[model samples]
Target: MKKPGRLLGSVSAAAFAILASSPALASGTLAGSTITNTVTVNYQVGSVAQTATSASNSFKVDRKVNVTVAETGSATTQVSPGQTAAVTTFTVTNLSNAALDFALVAAQQSGGTAAHSGTDNFDVTNVKIYVDTNNNGSYDPGTDLEVSYLDEVAADASKTVFVVADIPLSLSTGSVAGVTLTATGREGGTAGSQGAALVETTGADSANTVDTVFADGAGSSDSARDAAYSAKDDYTVLAAALTIVKSSKVISDPLNGTTNPKAIPGATIEYCISVANAAGGAGASNVAISDPLPVTVTYDSGYGIFLNGTVTSGVCNADGAAGGSYSSGTVSGTLSSVAAGATKTMRFRAVIN
Candidate 1:
């Protein structure tokens, strides 16, 4: 017959190995789940079989509350002045052991450093929050469902969120607007409706009751173990800054030929208008320049208006395609486009009255 001590030791080792091979649940043991442990002892006394004895204990699993908030992209979101429905994306994940609700907020920063290297200089208008309706990872203005808070988010799952806003008009290029998306952990286990704010259990743990414990780390605008987290994002403006300048010079007169000519009667005068776009600014299109001729000069119909000319050293060149109109005492021309860090000129020659 086998020794009792050796047989019991072999059985215990086999039981431990079986327990270790069991797979772990995604969210661990569910909260409010009753976990019971029982031990049974059987032995033979004085060569006779004895009855088995058993002991048992049970406790309820506690809830572990946790969450994470992160900006979806690495670079600053590029935007335009007066743009509507500009979007910034973020992800909110539930790390808790039970389902939970989260309240969302889009907060603007004032006069400080922004995410991805920039300074906050302005605020966006009509800021709102929306949840991704189709998991497409892109913001859909009318298709996405707008909500003030997330409801019944499953544990270990994530939800994509959008911060939609309108950009103010006349914002300069490189202007930045910093924003933070905050998600506060709230009560869960409900469906359709938003639950109340989550509260941590402060007293001792009760074996029969499930207690909540916060386990979230610090975020952009929140502290650790606060049941809330935040992530930062910013919008940078991209626009064109255009400037126009006009200059006049006497080309010839009745007494001079391509020499030191003066603005006298019957003298040929050349006019130049330059349009320059600032560097690092957006390209301008369909640029139109209109100049009304002064009473002292007459239209030089012999030399028609020169459109889409070139400028060098702050001087407009006369080499341009002849494509402009002179009517109603005004000179008008329309340019196709003026690229950034580039200049276009319009030139014409007239005679002094």
Candidate 2:
């Protein structure tokens, strides 16, 4: 259970002396660099200067493997249904004493608590991972290179990553999809190609070579000292939700007029269709309604039609414009727009043939 950074028995206590000296750098000392300390003893023998004696001790600095993955934004990413290429950003920082490569992975939560303050109710499609090659802190489709791993990131440096995915059209408002980003540490020394996976040095440390240590802390999803870290982000749907309702009533009859009219052969009937959008949702545009006349009913040309009316107390008001038309035994009308939490209705009169 001993940690990796400890000075092992490869060098005796008497041989390597502990000192307050080491190669210092702003970021950190190089992994394999040697640190040597020498002490010289000067004395006088019988009031005469004697030959000076000196002893030197040296050891290689061990490699410390550490990394951190953090989600960039403070809140969940807001997205709409059927949205494409929605991006969630993260930052991967190398905290090790040496440059390293990091393998990237983006995963989705099946169904559970999301990274934010809501429950994950759905999963996004076409998920992909990309690196910010230009370091612009934003994702550009063709400009930012899509990558599976980061190459040779220097010590104490950070790189930006993006997780892009498509939102399914079936999602509803307030639905959430959670995603996690993980980066695993890897060996780094070559110029272009990715290095092999990193393994912790076990048992005694070699006297001459540098030992590897996993010193990273636990992240949102990964365990501590595992040479990997993870962070979570989520997307919430904010699309319009529309609902339609149609109602009809017997207005009058050829014999009774407006007095207790029955569904006689010459009865007059009125139809009202209401379209409503849920609150806190996006506005709906170009809303159109169509109703075809039944075999036993005929459109009343004298009464005409009403479009873009209002609904109150579950009843359609006649305060709409005369814009609807009847063609081929069908009534059709179009509303310019419907705001959120608002309802627009279409009304028309027909005769019972």
Candidate 3:
């Protein structure tokens, strides 16, 4: 007896070829989706055609969880001792396809070779983290939500958080502190309990089955699908120091003349004012120095006050000719900027009344 001429094999091969060539039968779907497939068989028996349909095969796409973090504000902020620095904002986004919660933690690192890197010799006090509830991209006290960890964030959604800290009074000038914020995915419920998985069904009344198609290569459940991410910011302390000193010397006396001048009536006394800035401190801006003539003395209109021994019209020129000016009983000057370890002097003469 002759064999069946491989009719069944030929039919199976033809069906597979048709399935492979048809674009409508492609095999990929988005995460958290379901794929259903069915096939029909057709054959001819002695010129009589017959058809039969096969059962449907369905597949569920597993969930994929991922997160990203970024610092939203200026990369670096300047602050003074005992001052509150500008808030550093961070945005955490859930790149996953399912809703999930995240646990947030902050850390401070000191001294590295990179730019803005220095030993954080001091600690910033009263540091607090808050959520930007109003979505204004800023940290507003008494208005924005404050939470220890991030609450439920929808897939492809983001949440903004803030880090507000104070520069301790004891922190030295030029000291720097680096802050890093980290976000980790939180597994739901008690130990060994798989958190809510991405459901294949939509709306209410959906089943709780896991979508194995998108499952992680490790085969872990949805709760273990997500991963962590982090970002960083820096703070530098600004310390400005200013000091002033006054000195006086007798220029001349009507009775004793210029040599061995006395403080008697009709004697001329010279006054000097010295201003200095501490070393390694931030430059002082718009500095104004003023001195009032002693009540016991009179202003000598003919005498010129010298600024760093120049600009002799009662105005000091240490910063520039326009740096110093004087009126009837008082002398004042504005210095555009005074750098660290720099000093300027002002001198004027007054005669005893």
* Per-model CA lDDT versus the true structure: 0.86, 0.87, 0.64
Off by over 4 Å in 2: 1-27, 189-191, 248-271, 280-282, 292-308, 320-336, 347-353
Ranking the candidates on TM-score from highest down gives: 1, 2, 3
- Model 1, 33-116: lDDT tens per residue? 665555577889999989977655556778988889999979898998999999999999988888899999999999789987
Model 3 lDDT tens row, 1-353: 11122223222444446555745311222345554444456768898887753444444444555677777765466787778745677898876656667777766665552124555556676777788988988778789865667766766779998978888776668788777777765543333333443333233322234432222221111233335666777678878787877778888999889899999889998777766778988777677778887779986657665564332343334332323556877877666667777776667678898
TM-score between model 3 and native: 0.60
Which residue pairs of candidate 2 clash? Answer: none
Backbone clash pairs for candidate 1 read none
Residue 104 error, candidate 1, Å: 0.4
Candidate topping TM-score: 1
Clashes of each: 0, 0, 2
Least well predicted 10-residue stretch by lDDT in candidate 3: 213-222
TM-score of 2: 0.78
Per-model TM-score versus the true fold: 0.83, 0.78, 0.60
Model 2 C-alpha lDDT per residue in residues 205-299, reported as the tens digit of each score: 76468999999999878999999999999999888889999998899999999998988999999989999999998888889888988889999
* Quality of model 3 by C-alpha lDDT: 0.64
Native-referenced Cα lDDT, model 2? 0.87
**Rank by lDDT, descending?**
2, 1, 3
